[model samples]
Target: MLNIKNLQVGLEEEDKQILKGVDLNIGEGEVHAIMGPNGSGKSTMSYVLAGKGGYEVTGGTATLNEVDLLEMEPEERAAAGLFLAFQYPVEIPGVGNMTFLRTAVNAQRKARGEDDLSAGEFLKVVRAKAKALKIDADMLKRPVNVGFSGGEKKRNEILQMAMLEPKMCVLDETDSGLDVDAMKLVAEGVNALRDGKRSFLVITHYQRLLDHIKPDVVHIMADGKIIKSGGPELALEVENNGYADLLAEVA
Candidate 1:
């Protein structure tokens, strides 16, 4: 459902090229994992696709279901069914979690020309989704990610993903700060959202997370571009023998 061809990006301020030429195609219901060393442009690809600022798309095209994603604003992209779970979820000190979620949901609905959910209806849905993610009522009532544990913040991100129900989910280093049990909880939450029509682009550095998510394809990225593509075993190879051999082969 997502296709990118010869995509190129550079920092707007520095004019430093990040994505040399990234080509990827993710089919419906497919889960793809991107594994790369630091500075490999994995997160850059996600940020650009999500329409975040500060990056210039210097070349190529990216489309979702044949829709030109590069032309849409960030909010428009979200409304068009692109969701990004950040590596570090920011804290909004004054905005209550539930309130923020409801506003965001309604805003996206409005953008799509759908009616907003009633207060009661929204409460019920948020509660159910939060419960599934093991987020308690107290947590939901607190400010978004404010004073939350690292794992809790990550879980909150997953909760947002569940509520938004985006067609293409981009998880950038979602496993960064969790312990084994917490990681399993987050992974279970992600697995629950997988269906025959939704696609996931899981960006992680290690194979441990892959042990839970089980991607259909694994890509090794280096020097701003994807150098190799393989099955789940590729992640295993990276886990067992760092990126040295892979990088050497590409070099």
Candidate 2:
């Protein structure tokens, strides 16, 4: 479970506020989608939650299972069950995908006071999870995201999610780039990880991703605040009518 209360964040250098007293609570096993306009602070919320730099929390608190998240480093947050799939995955030239993944997994495990996975164990698990994401051996052997197609990069993100199996997954615009088939493939990979124990926060611009992920709740964000919360139908409204009317009504 994740809980945020009166959360306010701003750019560190600019000192300009982005999230203005945003509040949200996600129960276990729930998928919540955040739909908003370009400057609505949706990605800002995700970045802050993942402990990315350049943002300062000016007010309020966020917690995961009652653990204060704002105090942890990014890797500490990841070790505490936070996984963020970026809108634009960066390329790590020369770092094999498998090596990156194994290092990450072991680092988190060590952080949590668990032993590193044996080479054999690591290989077995990565292979199984990669196969599910349709990641071929060749792809795994290649440097992380280096020269990967957009779809492949996104799929690799999902594979990382699967391998980590974090309790809370925050996907920031994971649907930003993809063909119809590629989108479907990525969605299927996401759906396959859906069980009654993990929670998801899906931040997306379009309802097309929601059509596949099928969030349990949908939220409309505007002007750095969540103005309305509803069911899946809310996404359809945005899809059909756009945010102009919603913004007008809220205004």
Candidate 3:
């Protein structure tokens, strides 16, 4: 479970605030879709939740279950079962995908006092998930996201999510730049992980992805605040009527 209250965030060295009094709560097994136009601070919320540096919490609090999330470091947050799938996954020129995943997996396991997987076991586990997601073995052996297509990058993120199996996932624009097939692959990966012990906060601009994921709740954010909350039907309404009426209502 995750809870945020009157949360305000801004650049650490600047006075400009990107998030203003944003509040949200997501519980286990629930898939919540956050739909908003560009510059609505949706991505900002994801970064802040993930404890990215340079984002200062000017007001309020965020917690995972009973733990104060804002007090932890980014790696600590990841170890605490929080995962953020970025809008644009960065490429690491020298880090092979398998190498990167092994390091991350082992680090989290170490933090939790769990035994790290042997290379053989890790390969077996991840290979199965990668096969399900249509990720070739060659991709896993190559540098992380380096020279990968947009679809490959998105699928790779899902692969990591599956391998990590976090309690909560924040998918920040995972649908962006994805082809229809890629979108379905990513959505399937997400749906396969959905269960009573997990939750997802899907931040996206369009409703197409929602068609596959079928979120339990839909939230419309504007001007750094969540101004409207609705069900799956609201996503269709936004697609038809656009955010103009919603913006007016929020105003």
Inter-residue clash pairs, candidate 1: none
Given candidate 2, what's the lDDT at residue 80? 97
What TM-score would candidate 3 get against the native?
A: 0.98
Writing each residue's lDDT as its tens digit, candidate 2 over 126-226 gives 89888887889999999999989999999999999998989999999999988888899989989999999999999999999999999999999998899
User: At residue 114, what lDDT does model 2 achieve?
Assistant: 92
**Per-residue lDDT tens digits of candidate 1, residues 1-251?**
99999999999999699999999999999999999999999999999999989999999999999999999999999999999999999999999999999999999999999999999999999899899889999999999999999999999999999989999999999999899999999999999999979999999998999999999999999989999999999999999999999999988
CA lDDT, candidate 1, residue 160: 95
Model 3 poorest ten-residue lDDT run: 190-199
Reference-based lDDT, each prediction: 0.96, 0.95, 0.94
Query: Which candidate has the highest lDDT of all?
Result: 1
Worst 10 residues of 2 by lDDT: 126-135
Clashing pairs in 2: none
**Would you estimate the TM-scores of all the predictions?**
0.98, 0.98, 0.98
Q: Which candidate would rank higher by lDDT, 1 or 3? A: 1
What's model 3's lDDT at 166? 93
RMSD of 3: 0.8
Segments of candidate 1 deviating more than 4 angstroms:
none
